[model samples]
Target: EDKVVQSPLSLVVHEGDTVTLNCSYEVTNFRSLLWYKQEKKAPTFLFMLTSSGIEKKSGRLSSILDKKELFSILNITATQTGDSAIYLCAVVPSGSARQLTFGSGTQLTVLP
Candidate 1:
């Protein structure tokens, strides 16, 4: 069975602080790694990383994939209260039937 694990299930930080979220996985035929931010509503797609060592960034958020190590990391710099949310990590396995296997997620609270 495919498995994904995220560290620091919950974290609390002050506004302007920087945070790094982790995600590791063990699966057969890995395709890509994905990150999402979930607020009160549905999750919003953040990034999809397929290459190792290459980082993808947008605004204060950035993410990188390490296919060799079977892991990925999400970084948020100069965090704000608006960045407080549940960050989700999902992995897609390569095959005829591709599906997303998600981790428990990291709950980040940025205090004002």
Candidate 2:
């Protein structure tokens, strides 16, 4: 069975603090890993990692995939109160099924 594990299930940080979120997975056929941020309603796409060692970044946020290590890390710099949200990590398996295996997610709270 495909499985994903995220560390630091919850975290609290002050505004401007930097945080690192982790996601590790074990799957039969790995295709890609996706990152999402959920604030109020729907989850917004953050990043998608298909290659190893390459970092993806978007103002204040960045993520990298380590295929050899079977893990990925998401980094947020200069966090703000608005950055507080549930960060979700999901892995898409290769093949026709194309089902995504998701972790419980990490809830991040930023205090101003």
Candidate 3:
């Protein structure tokens, strides 16, 4: 079965701090890895990594994939309280029905 593991299950930080979240996975016939940020409701897409060593960034958020290591990392710089949320990592298998196998996720709390 495919599996994903995220490090530091939870974190506490203040505004303007930088945080790094890690995710590793093992899947058969892997297609890609996706990152999502879940707030109070639904999860919002962050990045989709298919190629190794390619970093995707937007504003204070950035993510990179290491296909060779079967892992990925999400970095949030100069964080704000609004950045607090559950960060999820999911894997897509080739020829699957677009179902995503997600990690337990990292809960980040940014204090004021």
For all predictions, the C-alpha RMSD in Å is 0.7, 0.7, 0.8
Error of 1 at 71 (Å): 0.6
Measured by TM-score, how close is model 1 to the native structure? Answer: 0.98
Q: What lDDT is reached at residue 88 by model 2?
A: 96
Instruction: Arrange candidates, best lDDT first.
Output: 2, 1, 3
Q: Which ten residues in a row have the lowest lDDT in candidate 1?
A: 91-100
lDDT tens readout by residue for model 3, 1-112: 9999998899999999999999999998899999999999899999999999989999999999999989999999999999999999999999946899999999999999
Query: What are the runs in model 3 whose C-alpha is more than 4 Å off?
Result: none
TM-score of each: 0.98, 0.98, 0.97
Clashes of each: 0, 0, 0
Per-residue alpha-carbon lDDT of model 2 for 1-112, expressed as tens digits? 9999998899999999999999999999999999999998799999999999999999999999999999999999999999999999999989897678999999999999
Please give, for residues 1-112, the per-residue lDDT of candidate 1 as tens digits.
Answer: 9999998899999999999999999988899999999999799999999999999999999999998889999999999999999999999989886679999999999999
Candidate 2 Cα outliers beyond 4 Å, as residue runs: none
